[model samples]
Target: MSLVFATSNKNKFEEARKIAEGHDLELEHRDVPYVEIQADDVVDVVKPSAQQATELLDSPCFVEDAGLFIEVLNGFPGPYSAYVYKTLQNRGILRLMEGKENRRAEFVSAVGYCEPGYEPRIFKGKVRGTITKESRGSGGFGFDPIFMPDLGEGGTFAEMSTEMKDALSHRGESIEKLVKWYVRNNRADGDRNESDS
Candidate 1:
């Protein structure tokens, strides 16, 4: 099976490819920018975008949105994580954690898939960990250097390689869930048609 992920982010696309390979499927990347609405959950934000991308591209596609939710901040920067990363960056985020004890944080990803005739399906994954006091590595983007997963040695996402991070990333997990579900449902090319109003 082959499908396109509605994103130009190389990191995300690459991760999808890796996960797809395990499922005996092919994953490709495409640029499909959509109006990302401010929503309380990542599912709401991704569903519309996924549907719009399928409409524009006329292909089976999925859109992903991931956020960094800090416990100390009362889940702040949850839906606004992208905006916060753009402005505050890693340094500013560390500063916000200065002299703070509760550094628990979770990285959550929601992936929405849309076919022409089917309702968008949302798959979600989450990784719970603590915020590092300082940035650690130079490999990843966004809050990778600060967000550590509770998986192995407790290293920051940036500190891990693409393969290592993909093994445990929220986005990777979500993509895998989608692929598995699609396969179980007997998905095929052109299985669904566009809905007419």
Candidate 2:
């Protein structure tokens, strides 16, 4: 089965492709310019984005949105993570945590799947971690330089390989759940049959 991924980021595309391959589905990147709406919650943002992408392409597609929530900041960048990352970067986050002992945070990912004439399905995944005083690693992008997973050593996501990071990443977990839902609901049965033929 083939599904359009509503994103232009090549790294995100590669990761989605890897996950889709594991579920026997083919992921096709669609360069759709989605108007990211400002919403009070993640669900609001994700569902609309998925709907817009599906409507524009007139086909089945999926969109993913993630955010980093800091306990100390009371989720300051909950839905505005991208904006925060762009402006503040890692150094800004580090500065915010300067002299503070409580450095807890979590990465939350929401994956929305939209199909023609069907209601969208949303899947969520979260990974706990702490903000580091200094950025580490150079493997991943975005907040990966300072976002350290709780399970791993005192290194940020940038320090981990793609495989290692995806294996334990919130986005990966969300993708896994989304794939399982698709299979159980037989939403891609037609595509599966076509591929078999």
Candidate 3:
């Protein structure tokens, strides 16, 4: 069986698809138009969105929301990262950090899954990093070109290949959690169905 991943972003869907494939799960992308709520954390933003998506599709589905939090800026774009990226973009962020010494930042991703008549389940992941002085590569979307993750070899997220980025990405971590949980639960459900038959 395939699980639906409701998102408008092809890039995000592709990234999550790759992770799901590694665990033998099929992910179907449904570009559902669901409203995201403004909240303190990405988790809060995704939970309702997932519930909305499940209602819209009349099936179990998942949605992911991510944010970029700059330590120096006091998480200026934590839950508002999408609007911030649309309005300010990466250049505006660099300009704000022009004279700052502390380039520390963090990227957080929350994947919320929901089935009909059930509350959404949340899986979260975060990665700490520093903002680059200038935009780097063209591999990733959003603030990727400007964020240098602390886990990798000094390269920004956009500088690395998709495989490399997935290995170190916050989205990857959260999606992995969702996939593992889905796999276990799905198998048990299949067994129950077979027993009933």
Candidate 4:
């Protein structure tokens, strides 16, 4: 009936709730201090955290991780987006792009889910865009103000409303995939229960 999402980011918590609501499901948020392993791939980074989180909570839980990769920078912060954000923030990123001609980039998100007896399931999402010339708008977080997605009218993620951003976000897309998996499994589970009954 409910799923647990383990993350420290309240922004992620809110988006996961929206994703669940969109699919007629309930999601509970917990900032479980699960260990996140540093890795080259997003999936690898998130799965261990998911495993530890579910074990700690003894419940079906998921962990989401994301990154912003820029083409010009040769993916300088592919799996290290969080660290880059903490160190460089937005202005530093813009400075890195000061004279670059190639501005292509994308945001990638990976969601990992786990239960006690099964392997963690991984779902991923990506959104293509470019780094803006300067920060724009006043919403969203992290690199939102500097990264403009290709989905909308040349607006940064920070410019879009939560509803608008959710519609085209990497997190939203991954959550959509996750919700589909949940729905299919839930239906199969209900069918099994019915047969048993």
The most accurate candidate by lDDT is 3
Q: What is the alpha-carbon RMSD of candidate 4 to the true structure?
A: 4.8
The digit string of per-residue lDDT tens for model 2 on 1-197 reads 66788987777778878887888978898889988898857777888898899899998888988889989899877889889988998888889889988889999888888887766778888899988888887788889988889886667889987777887888888887877667666674444211100
Q: Which parts of model 4 have CA positions greater than 4 angstroms off? A: 187-197
Per-residue lDDT of 31-125 in model 1, one digit per residue for the tens?
A: 87677899978877987888899898987888889899999989978978989999999999899999999999999999888987677878888
Q: Using lDDT, rank the candidates from best to worst.
A: 3, 4, 1, 2
**Please, what is the TM-score per model?**
0.91, 0.90, 0.94, 0.92
Point out where model 2 deviates above 4 Å.
184-197
lDDT of each: 0.84, 0.81, 0.89, 0.85
Model 1 stretches with alpha carbons more than 4 Å out: 186-197
Choose the strongest candidate by TM-score.
3
Error of 2 at 147 (Å): 1.0
Question: Which run of 10 residues does model 3 get worst, by summed lDDT?
Answer: 188-197
Preferred candidate (lDDT higher): 2 or 3: 3
Which stretch of 10 consecutive residues in model 4 shows the poorest summed lDDT? 188-197
